[model samples]
Target chain A: MMRRILSRPFAPVLALAGLLTSLAVAAPIYNAGGGAPRAVFLELPARLPEPEVALRADPLPSGRWRLTLAARHFRFTDICVLEAEAVPLGHAHIVHDGVKLAAAYAPIVDIGPLPPGRHRIEAVLRAQDHRAILGRGGLIKGAVVIEVPERAGGV
Target chain B: MLRVTSSSLKSGAAALIIFATAPPASGHEAWLLTPSEIEALALTPVPFVFASVAVLGPAAGLALLAAAVALALEGRWATIEERASPWLRGLVPSLGAAVLRVGLAAMLLLAATGGLPRHGTAPWTQSTLLVPDMQLSLAPGWDILIVVQVALALILLLGIGTRLAGGVLVLLSGLGLWVFGAEFLSYAPHFAAPGLMLMVIGGGAWSADALMRHDAPDPLTGPAAEALWRGARILVGAGFVYLAVAYKLTQPTLLIAILDHGDFPRFGMTYDVIALIMTGVEIVCGALLVMGRLVRPVALVILGAISFLAVVLGETPLFHANLYGALFVFALAGARAPGPRPSRAAWRMA
Candidate 1:
């Protein structure tokens, strides 16, 4: 009677058992490849230091210059540049600084070649609404000397 | 009977094992992570491994413990069962069934208030249909659903309208399946045992369904009828587990992902391993449930497996709703009085 009781339920049980055993033994494998590229990582300080700027100058083959500036702790929603000579501050254009090229809110910007010589690059931080100067006034400034290496082989 | 008892003991041991192995909840016991961590994990995808295990482990332990206790005390004379008048013998099952229903409702309520609200808009109150967009709109018809679910829970708990209540619960399960989509998909593999058990078995000896049967002729009183009912339940349970395993096999990445994440510090190695082990255990339990050799033991294992998947996996709200119904059936299965005498004519037909 006990055997009969136990035996009655075997067929379905065995079937399920077989199925589970097969799955466990087979064990699935996943392809680790085929995923997206990593994004650039930036580490910014919680608050920027006061208005300090640094610059590097690269001379292009066309004799135009690219000046990259890094400003420390200057916060702005938008960025703009005014020619050093034209500014109301009466600050003299240091030297051969040219037309303002491009402006950005982040610490980096590129300004170009006037007559290649010593020049002042002024970076101004502006408000989001574009109405006012960011801090006490409109301006933060940095300067770099650009000496285009004279072309060696060119006529 | 010995086999059943041994199986029960084994399940109880398994529960104890899981309970002992699980880590204490994190100091940061917040259900959701901080925004910074969310962003980082989204980019890295490493944290999910630990998080999944941590959530699933304790739930498994609790579920197993519940199953063990249920199995151990099954058919044993308890105050509720003994005091129940012969006429109210059916009430025993009804009360157990009620507990299952009400307890599930209570758990869902707690989860909705405590956890779900933090992540996204409440399903009932949210209007926007898009789940991922974080737009919160109350689900259309949510009020009626909640009201009816709560009412059914109350009726089941009160030992009123066993069959009709069970039927409504079955329907609710279907509705729940529709609304919760992906949220339910994560726990889809674990749905079979309880889903089948409840819908097929109709609350055992302790349910209102059984109580109603007592007053009326119960077809379930017959050995053949009882066997057939159990058989149907077993088949459903087995089929669910089989399908889940088969589906998992097709998606190897999920298994690999689970394994890769196994080393996460918060989830702990022991519990993570156990979670993986449970996948196999469930498949075996489901098979055993269907085979019907050691009905009691197999049922206990399946119950424990379900509990582990639900509680430790932290999927209680999603699956517990169905568990309420399944437990009602389990309670009845465990509560059969030791005789062949038909309690009512209805039982004979069943």
Candidate 2:
């Protein structure tokens, strides 16, 4: 029955117009036009020395996990700028279980006494412009999966 | 802090802004998440976003300027069309139809097979529809929809039941909207425009439909048919405009990210500058299409641009199979109609 109606040439015109209209009517409202947020990425230029990074997480006493970032040819800077840096260094995006947890300005990061379960933590090397720095093998970063055993008091 | 308010959306255009605002920045995000990016993108806070004054002001200005220039060129092109006889265009009359059929067929085939996934992912694993976002997994009765989609693709290929296939194309576009809602906005118009075009033109000279027809064909000549074709062209143009604004202008991060991902070489220019220029050119091309001015050139430019992206990004040509065919028709057929065509917007104003 639907096919029969669709077979008509006019049906498509109406349907498409209707769809377009519907979309325009239901746009997400943002306080934009004055200032809409734009993501700016600093692309690593060709022939640049690629920086590499590795992660090592140690469980601290207070249920806080301390992560030590071991990086090569890349410096972890405290400079919070939106421009491309002179060298491949800015900060790191510490992702906890798939969500962006925090931007680590320095090498070491202390993450939460996360809920008692397994957590997949990833640290991606980011340039000054917040782009995940890319190397030959792919994103110049490191990741590790950790399991948080249930504490005595279920805390 | 980005403020998202539903109260701002009193009309459809307002909603379009949001729809345009919320696209993921690039294939890089997809790489990070391993193809879960599309799902993640729908949960937009700040992904590939750019509706800022810096970008939109210039992009919108470029579109307006392009429309003005195209309106001017429209007169000269019409004169050239009246005088110069292009032998390849409509010479066979069915060649355009045949080309369109084959192009759409290939796209549908790729989509049905997931031969052309939107993300740089394993084929047949993610995409099973015309565009990347319209995942078959998201739709209800997708199992049935896939069969219908594939069947339509086959029919369009064979040119056995073309008008019916075109009709199905329209329905499929509608179905995308029904299932995916606003997310489908970028793709729906492009698909439906061609679908309507196919319906109007039928399967040109080489199609099985043409073979079956005993009487003289009357598909491309009439005033109504010509108007529909013009309308279809405008719709295609508008789709381009929407994409240019929504993706490139508003959400420039994605474009930049993709360019960066491919290590798109800059001729001593920053990625931002290059991104701005690309956005401007796309707006111009889309505006020309909408104005029906310099259509052949516009079509060629679009064809070249999409082809370049596919090659540079290492994507399959079949990803934009529909566009290739539609552009081919425009390049060959030109914008002139067989009969008395509608006047330009300027002429009407005069």
Candidate 3:
């Protein structure tokens, strides 16, 4: 009985073991790095060679203020705009802040033609690989303070 | 009388020990699925569970019925002299039964394969086809290989050449377990349970092997033979179950930190619930399988649960393998064998 049981077969067992070992070795590599390539913006020039700067706002607001500013190689996806707390200033916040929004992958828009007031603007970039943000992608620039004088009859 | 009773008690006890010690579920990781994905696949827990129970439960029940009928007929026909030459009579039915079992197994395999694409991404497709970074070949050719393996399993189940067929099925199942090992291991309880079941119990009395055994001595009669078969089964079953239980007991601790920290990719409430339920089912099924009493019924339930999960949770190859294993066991357990016919002295003792 012992012999019979022992003698039953070994070929299949060995084959299966070999197959399992191969699959085990292969699965992890596929799952870890399977997305799009990573990208980071090192530096952006303040003004592009060609610019009547293209500005667009996402979810056009009849009532709210928000927009994105892009020109040449610098394109922003889903930038948020807020009313400038003071006169002649505009503020922009990056929508997936600190994350490199995958090129057009992050739905950002440009908004403008502002009623001038003090404004703050920020930009961030995220890596395309699993959407990780590069280190300190956030940037704050432009009108920290703006003063628009009351002209003629306008208050 | 006391000896007979004691032996029965001992056998029953051994069966219990074997069942209880059977492995807990371990193997194969399922694809990360969301509630929306499950819904999109039109797989709700209730209907899938019902379909699973319906297919395997009835098959098991019928197999048991057939076993009971065969046992009764064996007893009544024991005295008949050469109704059709003993070899021919035995060989024909054995062949027919083997063919039937193989045919049924084939149909089930086909259905299972056909059902794969409709569900959300299978591990094979995700790992090989969709994910491009890996160097592995999607080997869409392997799908054909899988079909051939199923075909081989059918041939084996049919009992055309009992031992050879069993051996082939075993190989095919093992290869399947390996290729999809990670996936099955993650869902270990579900796949391991059925895989072990089939590995241990070949196509039962309904196969050609049983037909060949028509005139042979009762396998359970000799202590040595019984011990060998019983011990082998118990050791394998216990080993499998122990690993599973240990894994289940430790999974929460291992995964909780990741889940709570939100560091783990694709963690969700539904996946957690499914994992917990599966763990619970594995513990219970492992216990029941080792026990061996009402084995058919317990197996039926386990098979149903697996099938339900397969559909509702999205298709995993392991579930299909498990379903086949359970179905085979149910059929074998149900095959008719003679009840003990009492001798005059035995009757007097009783």
Candidate 4:
């Protein structure tokens, strides 16, 4: 039986089958818990461009403020292909006074209901996975200050 | 009994690994089609499918070992080829052309009506160019280009001036690529396939060009025609399958992530669920092409899906190439053979 299995014709097939069987039974191993696959991470190389972000703010009568964002050397995609996270394509995250706001899909976004005071707002472009889009120029960021009047039924 | 069961289990696992890795890694680059975009996806968690495949190395080895035994048992390669030749010849050009032609028309219509980037203002369209000044000026030109493209697609769909329309599409795509630079060169295969098909067939038998010239010889009659037609259908099918499995199934992170970008009309389904459905649709379309069943309509639907995807995700060069090629093929090879449709031809052919 061993001789028959070791023959040229059966050897390759046996080897292939053996390998496949092992693959089916073995569990996946990773260096980090729930981290990226090793092969995928291996393919990633450093290729960065100077991506810059700018912000423009306007107040609307409907008790909400609109924020417009622009970026140079970057583009945004509605869907983030995690495999494409290294690329300079992602949406912007709005930061109001150090608190994280919603993600901005387009160049313009509307933000809301502020008390009578001045507030600082910042916009940062993030990668597909919600990480910051950073290059040699550092993180892509823009900031602005806006004033809002108190509501009619203010506390 | 236990030994036998354990052995079978191992064999199954080995085969699984081999099957999983057989397809090439070409599809994962949907996002990384350009050099600059490579880093964007590299940092994210590996797509689940890819990650799974990556860990199947040992099984892959055993699968390779087992393939030899299977192949030996299968035997008589010449006999198999002889049996398949007639089927291949019958299916290639005739059925293949019909499917491609119809697919092309639907895709053209979609592009003309704004399913894809007929203009230069879109991110994928403009991303090809690094020059900000040139990007600004390209928008007006793109507007004109869209109109012209629409006219050509309509003409092609009607089977009028098929060759001319195809030639122009090739030129337009080429010009676009030239402007976009080498970053998009890899997409040439998809872009050029249709133009080459049109040029080869000129105007198909059912086309307006043929009707105008009664004496025109049938372009798909030669022995080589069989291979050509079969190749076309297979190419389209393979492309679809690749996109469905590789891009959608393997790289679903992007699709899921995009859900947060905007409100999509999902008809009560979540975007993630919708994405799976779309993937299933793509696979079905691809399978239809491979089986040469409902070629025209399925191709058209596939084109529409591609168009919709292009619009939402932005048309990458890959998307552009697929759209361009599908249009060319559709114009040349209409939905079905140019006579009373045979109801069970695809089944018979299979």
Top candidate (lDDT): 2
TM-score between candidate 2 and the true structure: 0.60
What candidate 3 gets wrong by more than 4 Å, as runs, is A1-155, B1-32, B35-104, B107-118, B121-151, B157-159, B176-278, B291-297, B300-304, B307-318, B324-350
- Please tell me which model should have the higher DockQ, number 2 or number 3: 2
lDDT of every model, 2 decimals: 0.38, 0.62, 0.33, 0.49
Correct interface contacts retained, every candidate: 0.04, 0.07, 0.00, 0.16
For candidate 4, what's the TM-score of chain A, rounded to 2 decimals? 0.63
Q: Candidate 1: global Cα-lDDT?
A: 0.38
Compose the digit string of candidate 4's lDDT tens values, residues B1-350. 34434444554553344336432222222322221222333345533432354533533453343334334543464355345434533332344344445555555455544443322124334322111112313333455655665676677666676656656756765665565443223233344456545544555556667678863324444545444444456556645554554445555545444433334467787665576566556644554454344455565666676666656655453335445455434422433222222235653664
Query: What is the TM-score of each candidate's chain B when compared with the real chain B?
Result: 0.48, 0.77, 0.41, 0.44
Report lDDT (Cα) of residue A134, candidate 4. 54
Per-residue alpha-carbon lDDT of candidate 1 for residues B187-303, written as tens digits (9 for 90 to 100): 332333332333333454555555665742232345644554554455445444543343322222233333333332335465334434445455455544544433444545555
Kindly report which residue pairs in candidate 2 clash with one another: A24-B12, A25-B12, A27-B15, B25-B254, B50-B250, B94-B205
Docking level for model 4: incorrect
| Predicted structure 4, TM vs. truth | 0.44
DockQ values for all predictions? 0.03, 0.06, 0.02, 0.14
Tens-place lDDT per residue, model 3, B111-230, is: 334422322333334222101111012233455554564565455555444434544544544554455433223233333333333333344456555567653222222443333334
Q: Which has the better TM-score: candidate 2, or candidate 3?
A: 2
* TM-score for candidate 1, residues paired by index: 0.42
Q: lDDT tens digits, residues A1-155, model 4?
A: 32233334444344334433443243233212333222123211356556788888876767667898878877876664322336677788787786666778788888876667888888877665444555543446788887665652121
TM-score list, all predictions: 0.42, 0.60, 0.35, 0.44
Compute the lDDT of residue A129 as modeled in candidate 1. 19
Q: Is candidate 1 or candidate 3 better by DockQ?
A: 1
Candidate 4: clashing residue pairs, number: 44
